[model samples]
Target chain A: MKTQRSRGMTPAWAVAALAISAGMMVVTGCHKKTSTPPAAMAPTESAAAPTATISADPLSIDLGQAVVLNWRTTNASSVSIDGIGNVQVNGTQTVSPSSSTNFHLVAKGDGGTTDASVRVTVRVPVTPTAPSGEGDMGSDALFHSHVQDIFFDYDSYELRSDAQASVTAAAAYLNANPNIKVLIGGYCDDRGSAEFNITLGENRANAAKQALVAAGVPAGRIRVVSYGKERQFCTEETESCWQQNRRDQFSIDR
Target chain B: MKASRQGLVFTTFSTLLALSILPAAHGQDWNVLETGKSASASTRLAAADLKPTGGAADEAKHTFDATLYADLASAGLFDLVSKSQNPQATPGSQSEMNLGQWAAAPASAAYVAFGNFAAQNGKIVVNGFLDDAKNAQYPQIFTKLYNQDDSAEGARQAAHEFADDIILRLAGTAGIAETKIFYTKKDGLNKEIWMMDYDGANQHQLTHLGAISIGPRVSPDNSRIAFSTLDKNGFQIKVYSLLLGRIVAFSSVGGTNLSPAWAPSGQQLAFSSSRTGDPEIWVSDPAGSLAHRITSFAGPDVSPTWNPKTGAQIAWVSGRSGLPQIYIMDADGSGVIRLTDGGYASSPSWSPNGQFLAFAWDRKYGPGAPGGQDIYVMEIATKKWIQLTHDIGRCDFPSWSPDGRHVVFANDPDGRAEHTRVMSMLADGTQKRALTGAGADMPNWSWK
Candidate 1:
């Protein structure tokens, strides 16, 4: 019986080699795996060897996206995927792979053990870089991000020490980009009257502009507007929020 | 002899009520005389629902009755009797009215106002009467007849006219029921100009500009509205002509321009302009021609409001003395005098009689300040002020009603959300109520 079984397995090995080559062709085409054909078993054998095939619906996916892996096996008592433990004999599983991975499936049956593999490639998105430095200063978003807003004390337009530092840095940026004109909008907290705050906010803006001019920024390149209490940056009754509201916000003219 | 003496007293009282129709110089003292009178002396008046006569629609009669009752109640010169206390009979004319019923018991009304409404041939006709409830011999005070379009709006207009006549006879001042209020309403990220009736009815947008438009000041003639708005150039004053229903061409000086106030003569405008480098008070003709800077100070001077009674003085907000303060100067910008001693004060609105200036003041303005920004009315002569709003909210932009009996302002009560509302109240800070919903700002009452 053993001799006959060995002889039967010989032609099965040859057929297995041919099926493996064919599976390689399929794999090359669409990253799918086809199992080797069932070995030619002896007629007296109790069970046939398992045949398995596995494939990914979409073999490629962007990072942070999910992909479905489908596998089918015949004559197998148990089947298991490499990363995802045991699964049903014929089923699908969804996976969000952080990186490219190879999904390997193994099927075990009374006749033999069968295996298949599929590769899923995850594509990482590329981020666009922002234009920076002198020539690129024309963008308003870049200008505002670089120049900081200066805050004032309650009901006072006098530039505090920290506000002066902000003004100096802003003047440096303005001087570096001479063609860029700036608009200084003065804002105030909601604590005071809207009408009185109009003048107060204007004074705060003018105070910043004067400091910028003193720091060598041209006065003609700067325009000022007072939002008064009409537009408040922070509505909280807290002191910190009020400080945020009383500020000289800088923006590009265009 | 006793009848003649009573007739003489009635004639004298009628003369006092008619003082507003006199020349400007004589009318200047009208508010003083009226203010000296006590509110306790307000006449108890009852307004009966309008009776629907032939072909009068129920909706029109309902509108007329509601408007008439609201006008008299809000007039600030009448103790309006509740509708529940009214007699069962709704008199449509003098013959149908029982004055004794209104003068006794729950109503005890000194005067009874009854009216009838009729719609015929696409026209609305109303017969309104006001009678002294106690004086049976001379019960009739006045009778008014109104004929207008057969619509709810027509009924409302007729009711307003009758209410105005009643207020004039009883309060000695023009009624504000027929007046309009121009304000700014937030639209998306922008604010547009809006107008509504004095009682917060018929609110509609006037300007469709999808930009920030605020500080609306209607012209004395009710023909144009001047407001500050952002454009491609910058902050500039624009005029909306009510006659043409479009924006009229106004000269745009290159700089920030804001807070356009119309002189009572309707020929000049006072505004704040930064055209000359610093924000200063400037005056120009109604057409924005012949513009000249009247103030040339280092600090910002803005929010110019004219003394409507005299048309000779200008009150504005100035920042020259550290914090902003209310200051008054001549029309040409001479004889400058500061009215507020300390704290933050601004948005001075001159009363029609030139006797008081209503403004916003933060008496103790600072971080974690104890008192809130409030509205105050100051007697321009004595400089003694009365706080009109107390800790209700950050109230500002107090615009006096045409009759000088009420003030309209903007109140910001919600702290962080920045939801602001336009509010109105009597000059004494009583009967406070909101005129517009949240996001309404800078209310300016019409001259009429």
Candidate 2:
């Protein structure tokens, strides 16, 4: 064995050395000038742990307008919205707040007690003035306003019985805000074929349109578009990401 | 041979017309060679000599000419010669053709396509002419598109479409635009034959037996199908008439009888069977009344497809060269010659043109994961080849659409379907559309 090894060793070791040198060359070749330390790593290391923040879009909501409250926390083990008798989390529950009601976001973490609250004053949504009719589009046309977010169940286009209340609420808003058209965009999770999902999303959006129109919202005030599973808010391929995908976003036009 | 014959014919015609050089309609001039009586006599005599002449060589040439004319006429692309039999005149000349000849060759119109199939740029190119012979003008320049990718088994489809287009252009009616392919699909643990539209729609199972079924073939009229089904008893050929929607044992022949293809007249089917203790192609009447053996190859000779334009010729895949290769021979199984040279190629489908054969070429590689199956096309004359699919996934059982412009095959689009799904693509291997239904395979394109 030793004799045979020695006979093939010289050339083999040379090839081995060459290969090692080639690999080292590649590694060292990638070295760049040590500029300032990476800004991203430095900020996270020095700053206090990123605490979750919760806030409503509008601090003070006029009775009818929706105050979208959002929350996030790096340390919180579990966090949810509490208080405000009928405060809803879109898919979770329905919210019917009064003057004395406050929306509470209780977040518990390893560091300390952290709580966020939004005092939601419930009132009838206000009616907006009709367009002056000076724009390129007609006042009754769909191009002037937008709808917000709609929701759906897991892998379903059938509007759940629970979703009707949200649809009714949005319809009431549309009824008050005349001359504004809203576009309802339907979406589906990244589960099935894209083509199938596109059809499903379209069906969901149409269902919403049907419900809103039936609820007294002008047919012309609602337009439906299906984005399918295209605009995923979360890139992760997890259940949570999928949950976020089954939704419809509303956008109002001029 | 073509150039020499062209030279001889051209020289002879030119000498006869040397006296007059007045240009005719197009660029060529008509000299009215010996205009008055002698010219008339020459044609009369040529027309009077109707008897087929000479030995095998002359007979073969005459057959080739007749084959070409019949194909062109049926293709609705050429004029047939019904004038008195012109046995004296040489092939390809006006002496044999009377202006008023062949008035009944379908719609009072005849088209002649003359093209040479050759290997070009690593692929086969069949470029020909669509001549409106009666009108004395070129209708269109027809081309049979081919690529090496399809040479494995799709050449027949490419050629069929090329021929169909000739008929469509001249008749203003789609030719063979309705036809279905019958093939076996892997269903669960067993392979079963299934049928579907030419575009891979409305796919349904034709057999539900736990036994294995393979090699389903559609009849010429697209009304019936035949295939081999294996039972504990043994392998047997079964025929299913679409009109009746019933399955029946065909021929009661002992042993395995498979790979049945329809004749042009839809009167007979050419199939391979081991009833004689050796696999060979046999032609049988629809009633299975007359069984004639067409092949006696020592090795396995299967997957036989008959030429629609020539009742006397057939194509089948033979494993004579250690590996399966396609071979074309007389309908009686004479004049056998290997047409393909590659690995594990089988299941040949004849084009309507009688000019090409399509078949599957299964390529095997070393251990880890085997290579995929592909469709290929081959020109009968020049033996040029084109390969069709290259996806890593297994692609098999290609069925040509009725129009012959597309081929439908079964493949797992996701690369890993526990069960296969049917997919189709245009003849050129573009515009692939997957069928939406769940767990589908063994798709046959229906003539409807």
Q: Highest lDDT among the candidates is held by which one? A: 1
Clashing pairs in 1: A235-B416
Candidate 1 per-residue lDDT over residues A1-254, each given as its tens digit: 00011212443333333323343344343445565555554465667877777778577777678988888888899999998999999999889876667788888888777777877766544313232322333566667766899888887889999988888878877877666788899888867655556667777888998898999989989888878776677767788888899899998876
Q: What lDDT does the true structure give each of the candidates?
A: 0.78, 0.51
Which 10 consecutive positions of candidate 1 chain B have the poorest summed lDDT?
Answer: B5-14
Runs of candidate 1 with Cα error greater than 4 angstroms are: A1-146, B1-42, B55-57, B232-234, B416-418
Tens-place lDDT per residue, model 2, A1-254, is: 00001111132232223212232234322211101111242242443222333444443444445555554445446566665333222223334332324556554444333444444443333445433233322243332232346667654566776667678777866777664577777677754332224435555776787788898988767666555553456556466767677876665644
* lDDT score, candidate 1: 0.78
Q: State the fnat of candidate 2 relative to the true structure.
A: 0.00
Q: Pick the candidate with the highest DockQ.
A: 1
Query: What CAPRI class is candidate 2?
Result: incorrect
Best by TM-score: 1
What fraction of the native alpha-carbon contacts across the interface, defined at 8 angstroms, is recovered by model 1?
A: 0.36
Candidate 1 TM-score, true structure as reference? 0.74
